[model samples]
Target chain A: MIDYRGLQALAMVIEHGGFERAARHLFITQSAVSQRVKHLEALIGQPVLMRTTPPKATAMGQRLHSHWQQVRLLEAGLGIASTPNQLTVRLTVNADSLATWLPEALVLPDHPNVSFDLLVEDQAVGLRRMRQGEVMACLCASAEPVNGGRVAFLGYLRYRAVASPEFIANYGLKDLSRLPDAPCLVFNRDDPLQHEFLATVVGGTPQRIHYCPSSEGFVEATRVGLGYGMIPELQFRDLLASGELVDVVPGYALSTPLYWHYWQTESDVMLNLRTQVIKIAKQRLLAEA
Target chain B: MIDYRGLQALAMVIEHGGFERAARHLFITQSAVSQRVKHLEALIGQPVLMRTTPPKATAMGQRLHSHWQQVRLLEAGLGIASTPNQLTVRLTVNADSLATWLPEALVLPDHPNVSFDLLVEDQAVGLRRMRQGEVMACLCASAEPVNGGRVAFLGYLRYRAVASPEFIANYGLKDLSRLPDAPCLVFNRDDPLQHEFLATVVGGTPQRIHYCPSSEGFVEATRVGLGYGMIPELQFRDLLASGELVDVVPGYALSTPLYWHYWQTESDVMLNLRTQVIKIAKQRLLAEA
Candidate 1:
């Protein structure tokens, strides 16, 4: 097996570019980086770094780096004390979720030992990071168990079809079947919620669909009469209350189930965070419906 | 912006426990851990760790750990290389896909810089992980775009209700409505593909649903006359070809559309992966039939 330190050194070399740069980043001499890389090459029996030009990792080097990340993540998950005073946990999150639930969920406030490096992606991608030992835990939608991890249900995110009152006035939709003729705002072509609803109730497809990629914008488009789209209840509640938005279908709503997935490895901080997230999810989001 | 290193150090401390243990794991001295922790505290103007018997991070420490995770992912997406050579791309995928598409997708002939960590989960919960930045990408069923990313339609995973000739003879499922009354194998309660098919085609529900979580077991259960199930086309292809497993509905198959979601970042590696994935998806998975 290759030494862990060598892998770290090679990783630094690749990241920092060239021996001198890596040496500077590590606060060591350029010769030290050269020696480490040479030693790593001897151990791996392969040239991990291309010594020419900008100094890049060979194909084998990239693979080693990937493995190194896995080792790091595993180490993190094991909760095997690395340093009593290191105060950081990498967090993966979705952007809209960051804007909404995360602020609400992470309300405990102030820690010197812990600092958050938030990576915002879609939920599915985040789960991948969790399993790879990248982030310790994640909020995902998968109910299927991840290897070395436990899965929990976080409850459904209720959504409803809403449009600006102006839209309603112009489109004059009295029944579901007429929705196909009206312009509609969608998150993208893949969003099937609106399509499912239409297929279930209207027996047709929306005639015109506008892709509004942002969550806030998707809702705003509907509010401004661009078209009808399903909006999450949490973000749209006040709008509905204020009558800025009205239900296209008063009694009908879409509820999507959310779940949390985390490494099953015993980590006190992860355990605590998961507990707190679930508690808030149940109290603030799930219970509201 | 806060120095991300501080957060990483803090996360390590929380994971490890005491300064001595953390120092050992980090290959540093106990004094170094104490110094870093102290420095972090001074920077944040808050005490993240409690000096108890074992030492523990405060609630604030926990929050920062989670926050730090997200930032690391964003940095990756931005191609802001960390620890140079070791670039780990994490993702959550389903077992079925792992068995089928994943190995083939990762058929890179020794490019060592890229290491893939596969987190296996069901389609239902994969989305949440994507949101958390745990992974850079995911294959999920949701059409809704995540907060910071775009949703791309990969293709549909088509499944059909199949059973052994003997099983069908025993159950006598001549009509769709008779399905609910007969013994049926299901992936889980969330395995609503069959239910949706029944509701859409027969306007009824299954009577006795047997839960068999494993993909292999689902097929076996149906073949051995345990129950009928909606089996994926890929899994049941050989059986169907051999006339062992017969499709209950020949022309009718249930198709679930899957989408690939990733952070909209300008990383060369991510872009390359996405491009390759799309190419394979088009060739292997049928888009429209």
Candidate 2:
């Protein structure tokens, strides 16, 4: 049988990126930490770490690390009474979700004794983190679940192609034909909502483009007429109502379906967290089948 | 024969991520932008864009986009007089390079009329962005050049395992063995310099770890004695001189070699940029083969 302490040492090395740091984390002698890893490697009769500039786990090492993480989560869930401060929940999410509804979801009542480590990325890309075993759960764009994960539909996020009033007047963009020469704002290279809207109405790419990656910055860029862009309803409702921003192309919008995915776990903490996220999302986002 | 205007439309659509946006970028009517792309598609007898939420280029579309970008760069180099404000250069780099030496390189005498869009990631990951056609150049860890890029060696960045005096007194980490149990700070998951130092001294993974992703935050965390960490020598020299931090493992350090990789181009602008970057890197980083 493998020593749990040795396994823990291996996990920490990967986590901390070195033995000495791992030792510091464990409050043990660096030599002791090394001995444990060495012992574990000898027991397994294989090298677990590929000692490069920053050590990386071998394939087997990666498998072992993933195993240890799952076991740690399980043990933590069961031993909640024994260690109240040990809960560290890692997750991945999209920037829009984070900017809009996720913060409220997190502070919901009955939140377990846990702190969160969030990895923010585009929703389409966020699911990859779960597949790589980097996070326990993810708020992703797809409905399909990764292996051993439960997927729940979270509603669609509606977006309007909006521009400031000054921008509309300056560009004189009364019809789709005039859109080509006007500068447009995009969240990033990978953001497609603007493209989808354009394809539906104008059927080509914009002639001039400005890329703004931040959610708030994207809105601000649009507000200042840097370029018109698709703004999430939740983020732009006030500006739209105040007439600070107007739909450049009235009667047209885009809706993106979102999903919550979590590693299938019997842990009550995990379930409660998932339920709260879904509940908050439903209240905040557009409900769609 | 393929119309160059149609090809430009396709490229803009892919770059800007939508048709109307592409039209705006081109300073043409959206219908004209659409007609150009449709004309190109008819000539090619294949749809180039995937029409996904954030439109993706089909394999053929990717090839065309790459070709168009190359042509645009060449034209810009030749027609420098026609458009003085059109030069926008995109590149990816590691944070340490940004925090230390890169900004100095940009303002070098006779610097071209260019604006930079920088994508910050780890050196190992940044190179992939170049490979994916996301950026024109990258400063990466590997010396191996990408398929069509010129690679020049930038010297090594030396790092030292450092701790505040207060932390040393509290943990009593005089010897390598005591490192395992002491909390250590990590820049991010991919940072392994601390691990490399630990493996050399005590030969194991750390038992306790704290991850601080931001470069500035990592330094601040270490200064506050949250944990010792491997800090870039350039970043910590003043702190060490002032006795705010001490080398935890004296006489031992980690050195990461960096390289500047840029697309092979006849453009004087490209060549000048490369020369400036190499010169600055040599002065700032540790000289090595």
- Where model 2 places Cα greater than 4 Å from the true spot, the runs are A80-85, A108-113, A122-125, A131-134, A207-211, A241-244, B1-74, B77-88, B91-289
Q: Which ten residues in a row have the lowest lDDT in candidate 1 chain B?
A: B106-115
Poorly placed runs, candidate 1 (over 4 Å): A1-289, B9-26, B29-85, B108-111, B122-124
What tens digits encode model 2's per-residue C-alpha lDDT throughout A1-289? 6677888888878766688877877889989988998888998899888877567889778777867766766776675566543345677777677656665565423533454555667766777767877677888788899888889899998889999888888778886788866766666677777878787888876655555555655666567656789988888888988998999989887898989888877466678778888898989888963
Clash counts for all predictions: 76, 43
lDDT of 2 by residue, B1-289 (tens): 5578888888778766688877877889888988888888888999888877556788778777766665666677675576543444567877677656665565423533454455677776777767776677888788898888778888998888998898888778986688876766665677777778788899876555555554544565577666788888887788899999898988878889998888876466667778888888888898963
Task: Please name the candidate that would achieve the greatest DockQ relative to the true structure.
Answer: 2
Task: Please write out the lDDT profile of model 1 over residues B1-289, one tens digit for every residue.
Answer: 7655566667656544467766765678788778887888888889888888557768677566646644544455555445342344566666455434434454332332454445556665677767765567887777787888887777777788898887677657776556666656555435677778777777876544545444554565566555677877876788888888998777888787777787776366666777767776776676974
RMSD after CA superposition, every candidate: 27.6, 10.4
TM-score of 1: 0.43
Q: What is the DockQ of candidate 1?
A: 0.01
- What does candidate 1's lDDT look like per residue over A1-289, in tens digits? 6777678778767644467766755678888878887888898888998886567778788777656644654455555578332233456654335434544354222222233334555666777777665565666556786788888787777778898887787767875667887766555433667878787778876544554444554555566555788877777788899999999889998777777777666455556667767887786565433
Q: Return the TM-score for each candidate structure.
A: 0.43, 0.57
